[model samples]
Target: MGTKIGVIGGSGVYEIDGLQDAAWVDIDSPFGAPSDQILTGRLGGVEMAFLPRHGRGHVHSPSTVPYRANIDALKRLGVTDVISVSACGSFREEMAPGDFVIVDQFIDRTFAREKSFFGTGLVAHVSVAHPTCPRLSQACLEAARAEGIKVHDGGTYLAMEGPQFSSMAESKLYRDAWGCDVIGMTNMPEAKLAREAELCYASVAMITDYDSWHPDHGAVDISDIIATLTGNADKARALVARLPALLGPERAPCPHGCDRALEHAILTAPEKRDPAMIEKLSAVAGRVLG
Candidate 1:
């Protein structure tokens, strides 16, 4: 197998075509079962792992997806690069429906989730000031462009706690005051957890609606969002199809420092480190300990 690239498909992106030798692999992480059984296969001669964030039938809610379990499963599968494909509402006028954005920054507004792996017996704080791996983001942008999709190079994604769409006031605040490019649910703890797992993370934001900020559009419509999500899902698949080609057959260390995020993050003294915690973290932090 080649370098493992993990792809987490968001709403409406439950399947990826053209993966040869595909087989469903049920992964058990210390956190719990992943959103769904991981699909492992090869694309363009490169090994890839696909996991549907919302489960196969879109059963999980935004707040319910096991973010920690998902990341841990990817890590256990030896995933070096993770690409999160998410449907988002545009916060900017230029980022219209059907457009794609490679999110480079994030403002996490998630309220209910365990966003870290180092706590309790272990104490570690990884810097998330610059979260997304630039190299990976660049590759995703290039892949989208090469696939003939309209792609924005960089943007800040505001991850809100929601199965519900943002209110007009909240949407306007995020757009006008905070200056976010996109808004979505589910990217929070996912992004944070990816860092803790030492995986190079990149998100491809598929614009599905205009939230409630656009005067021309009424309050975010679930029906319209769902319709747009279908189209965006197709685009997401096209973009993913070109990823292996863009990334090439070999793997390179992340130029943006994403792969070594936990280098100095483990603060517990070696003798004081909890054996159980170390055992649990070994799957993700073995290199750091070694």
Candidate 2:
């Protein structure tokens, strides 16, 4: 099969433009309904799928996004690469508002959400030591540069569970103590589930504000964030538009083993696994299960 790129849009980004034969596809997944219908079509002669992390009209909150179903839906559609474009607050002065960071590491501090596709019935563990696919991330970096976006090549993202912005103390902890480069709400379980689904994933964090850490910036203001978010969204679209041309309509095995994550991850014996659970995981774990 040829390469099919999936773009998960967040915050101000609701849809992508310039897709040929674009259609909003309702893909069913055992996990649940995805955040919204996925928009699938061709861009630059390469298959592309775009899913709004929050449903259209911004219905779903960051914590409420159906991470499992979103990943499963894309995998079922044969999406080989998943690129997450999300709005974030920068921890570093250099990664200021309107900048884009190609995130390579994550510190998942999120809770109150389903974080895996495997559980008691189907026990499995995938190594996420290096979660984002390097190859895919490099493409994002190049695309952003080509769009004249001030892009940072690598950064550690601190994913917090939130419908609320971070407190001053919390922001300080993540920036000063944790050495995190950016902070965002979505992207934790989403990144984790992508690894489990054996789909290569990359994250592009668009900086909107300095999260209560900068003395001059003070607290995060909704008005300011929304304003920056609007500009960032436009650049994000341009960056995504350039991806298909760089990645081309061809697929290759992930050198970093993102596509083979479940090779030795499943621990349950064939007979020991629950039949119902196995059936539910068919789309996500079909290769290993078969």
| RMSD in Å for all candidates | 1.1, 0.6
Error of 1 at 157 (Å): 0.7
Candidate 1 lDDT, 108-190, residue by residue in tens? 99998889877777788898998888888888998898888899999999999998899999999999999899999988989
C-alpha RMSD in Å of predicted model 1 compared with the true structure: 1.1
Among all windows of ten consecutive residues in candidate 1, which has the lowest summed lDDT? 281-290
List the candidates' TM-scores in order: 0.98, 0.99
State the lDDT at 45 in candidate 1. Answer: 85
Q: Which runs of model 1 end up more than 4 angstroms from their true locations? A: none
Residue 20 of model 2, lDDT score: 98
Highest TM-score model number: 2
